[model samples]
Target: MRERFDVVPLAALFLGAASFLMPFAALKENRVVDGLLLNGFQLAGPLYGTVAVLTAFGVLTGVFLMKNGSRRRLLYAAAGVVCFWLTAALLVRAGMMLTGGAAPRVSPAIGFWGLPAASYVLIDHSKKGRWRMWILLVVMLLPAALLLAGGRGEAISVFREWSARKGRFFDELIVHIRLFGMAVISAAVLGIPLGILASRDKRIGEPVTAFVDAVQTIPSMALFGLLMAPLAALSRTFPLLRAMGIRGIGAAPALIALTLYALLPIVRNTVAGLASVPLSAIDAGLGLGMSQRQLFYRVEWPMALPHVLTGLRTASVQAVGNTAVAALIGAGGLGIMIFQGLGQAAPDLILLGVIPLILIAVAVDRSWGFMIRRWVSPGLDMKGLSA
Candidate 1:
């Protein structure tokens, strides 16, 4: 057997070198003005700059030196995360050194993003791990938390934007979560039964699934646009809906659009889950004189739970990202910040909004998965059932 060289660490090293060769940080005079592009050496000075270089280099060289795969993985994960955190810190430090520790409009440049993204990918193992993935998130985020708590991050461009809009941030974040949450929950409630029905009855299933799948075909913005007219009419005709804030350009339309978008993955997965249930198990349930409802509740549904959760997980993550577009219609989420940032030509404001949006998606993806793995019976998994 040939020894397989680890490409992960090499990729990390390539990204790190790119960080050194290209601009590591962009320096701006103000939030909306362009300035200079600073390399790692230019931004962090000798000590921190040298450390960054050595850290990045050590990740690849050290990993190759170790023949043991476990040791190589451990080294790369540790070094990669450190490089990522350190790159962020360097951006913060650069701001301080240049602007007397007050707010500085310094953002991570293209080169800076490559390394951290590579590092993040390095530790983000299987999406299935109960704790491993969460632990990686914590490890990755701790530096940001500490910098913010200790106030060192205040000078960084992204934090400066946050400080300016702290109140609006929370308000918009709540709306974003609400839109995403309601959409996914609504999808699950409506999708699961339809999925089950489709599995149990071909007549009802084919067209229903076809429609749900068709919903996904429409561009999200176009779907949102299509809903606007009916929603606007409803609000005008129904005083109660108007009183309840069911407007065409706000949460009501946004929520409906997001829910429609969320249904397909869920319905597809639910159908798949139920379809995948064993004939033997169904026969056993029938042998005990169990009716269809009893079999579904007691045997089929329970056995298909992991797959259901998988669908829910998929829908939830999609909803979180899709909810961002809701901001365009005044539905409001972190997307507002992103759009505002773009309108104002302020990169930091965009980062403040975009980062949290990514985090929310990651949180939904991880937490739901963690719950599925931790609570769902090991035997209930599709793979287990097939075996």
Candidate 2:
């Protein structure tokens, strides 16, 4: 039987071409049209037309080389094109930044795969056992470099100017950090206990599971509103609680809302992980003269660690993204930029916020995923379980 060709690369190529052309057709002013086209070329120039054409040719050649076998060579060719484009884009961006050139017009197509390809290539090229450590070091150092190189100062100044009516950038950062921290901690505390209780008692499991499931049915914004009045009451009753007050608004309400949103996945995952432990393992532990505590701590918990970690990873990513909605309240976050941009009709500023939030979530998910795969699930290859 003849092998079928992979269509993904072809699709990506067509999509990229269309992305370049769409903006060209939309603009009316001659100078703006010319400028957009020029920008598109500069943006696409990193992966020159020649490179794309050659990559397509290489894919065709590989098909013949393999005699139409099931093996995948197109992935490599496509990856190569992506890497070349990304490297070029990064260098172009660096040059533009240094020389005070016109800002690179954003292309969603180019933006989507560029950095990811570059990062993947860098990691793939690094020596074994040290790749992750090096990646972390780069991540930590890049912001510092950008800061000292002027991006940080410029960002701070812009944010300060925009939020002058609100507060300092540091203040906004603190509020977001606190809200995120509270949501995470609260979810863990609530979820873990419920998970343990559910695992211990069959009667407790059904309703708790149902409740968490129902929580998911509630829209997040609606939940925020629902919690506002109760939280406000709690805040009013105790003067000491005033500092932690929800006020039916701001970070406190946002935190409560996010915590509620985060609870279900962690709780459900934890319950599933704990309950999935083999009965034979429990029997063996008991037969080995282990106490209940020992059986739980030494056997069951270790088996469940991967699952628990999986839940944490999921909850963390979800919290990071969902926290953006906290901007609807007074809790300031990167989402503030997104909302402000929407209000001002500036898509670039919206992307500025959204892009970083996505980067943060990806970074957290990948880092935690690596740790879970390498350490928590070492014996059984439970990386799939994390997924």
Candidate 3:
């Protein structure tokens, strides 16, 4: 048979190989100061040279040479991921071991960034990643998760930043989740009804559509600014509101603005999903003694659900990012660490905040995709979804 190269594994090889070519980590005296670059091979030469070199060869043979759909191909790819994982963990441990008496901290450098990036692509490469990849991926990640939970990543700069602020960090993280949840839920509550009305009545649809579309055009900062005054005034006017923390520059105004920004996507998708429902299905339901409401609930809604989930998925991810901006108005979340890191010129601190946001967004998006695939109405066309 002729030889063929898969883009996914090739991409993984490029990233992982490229990562080691440059500095793998940094040694710093303090969080904000200039640091010395350390090559993985130099810092932990025996470990890096052996594992990385062996894995590079393993990836080439196992992923590149093996036939597509072969179990061995997948096993090799998963092994490559696990090898890289051990290289990172053990290398960091060795590096930290060196710093015991000297006391200078170790931080990730530019090249260090590629390890996880390469692993992610490798994850995608493992048999289209539909089953979430070879068992090796799970085995490797389980301990990593546990270590992170146990706060054992002391060698990495971001982990150090996390160690310093973990108490407040958890608190801010919960608040951030709340902000994202409230925004998406509020938008869905109002947007879905408006979408239903819009589908049934063009008159109401056009105006509501225009209004939500206009809301999207406004910059988030400006929207937050606009809501603050009215909220502040309301709090002042109503002692009840003030006691409930409905101030202009806090969660109240931030939630209102985030909800407004989230509305357009939800409303637009709701309209699209409903309209996409087949008339034949509705007619069939009605002929079977179903009333209009029964038809909507039993026939139309089931068909439209996948699209509705898509819109909510979009809104959910968007809310995660926008919630970061809400921190500017004292609506606390991970953004507090980000802005504070910026003010102090601490890159690791910024990363401590930014990384979580990225993870949260990816988690939400993937969850929605999982829902559409597994839990949605069987009436949905798989072809449309794949497209």
Candidate 4:
């Protein structure tokens, strides 16, 4: 019989193995200039032979086993993960060795970045549920843990950058978090009521959603500019507001703009989720003689809750990304670092800001997923929420 194999994991493994031939990193004398590429052999140093052998063996063996329909898929995934971790470790070691006493910078290149993504595919394809989550977590953390323990490599470079501006980094990070947090909370508070009104009245819903959709079209920078004058006048007119740290140029306009940006998704999703509730459920609640308010609170809202949470999740991720743009107006978040990096042409500095933003977005999405799974009523089928 002809053998069959899983395509995705196999592709991921092949891609990862191919990355070994690409440049793993670059050594730079300064942030702005082009640096020299360090291939797998250079990156792995004394471990070059070991890394090369494993990359070839793992890819070949995994593909063969998968083709033969063996039950050892997880074993292949585990091996891929080990290869990935060792590759990262060696790259870090090389970076440290190069930058040990010199001021030269060691920044990760495409191969270094691509390897982890490919490894994630391997891990994800092989496992299910908490096992996948746990293994992924371990695979991700082990490289960092080893880097920290060794005190070397690109990890050291990022840490050095962090140390140089540690105070500013944390402060700006806090501001960035607060800005998006306030925006999302305000959007939810204002959005849910508007959503409820819209769900109950077509007249109200049409105008409200249209207004939100219109607001969403305005460029963030332009929105900030639009709010600047009005807020400035307000702050000047009301000394109390100025004293309360409500500034037109800084966080105030940024917050307002982001809040408006967050509204459309939340309100639309809320309306959609509520409207999607079963008519049979509504009639049954009425047949039981519940008041309109009682029926909504006890029935519709419970059923609509998951969809609403999904909306919140969408808004939150959007807000986190938009917060980066808010830094242009001096709102002071990771965007500040990002822009500074751009100005200086420092990729590592940019990563310092961007990596955290990506992580935050992922965390928000995962947390919401977990909550929906745990808190939403099992009787309600929410598979249609995105509809």
lDDT of 4 by residue, 147-265 (tens): 65655653444665777799999999899899999999999999999999999999999999999999999999899989989999999999999998787889889988999999998
Tell how far residue 308 is off in model 3, in angstroms. 0.3
- In order of appearance, the predictions have TM-scores of 0.90, 0.73, 0.90, 0.90
Clashes of each: 0, 0, 0, 0
Tell me the tens digit of each residue's lDDT in model 3 across 1-387.
775646766666676765566777777776766777866566656765677668677767765556777575566466556646654574455456544433356777777766677777665555545654536657767766665454356656777787777899999999999999999999999888888899899999999999999998999889888898889899999999999989989899999899988888889988998999878878888889999988888888878787788888899999999999999999999889999999998888888889999999988988888887776866568555531
User: How much lDDT does each candidate structure score?
Assistant: 0.79, 0.63, 0.78, 0.79
Tell me the spans in candidate 4 whose CA falls farther than 4 Å from its real position. 1-5, 45-60, 63-73, 76-80, 99-102, 154-156, 384-387
- Could you give the C-alpha RMSD of every candidate to the true structure, in order shown? 3.1, 6.3, 2.9, 2.9
Among residues 3 or more apart in sequence or in different chains, the pairs in candidate 4 whose N, CA or C atoms overlap within 3 Å are: none
Clashing pairs in 3: none
Better of 1 and 3 by lDDT: 1
In model 1, the clashing pairs are none
lDDT of 2: 0.63
Deviation from native of the Cα of residue 142 in model 2, angstroms = 8.7
Native-vs-model 1 lDDT?
0.79
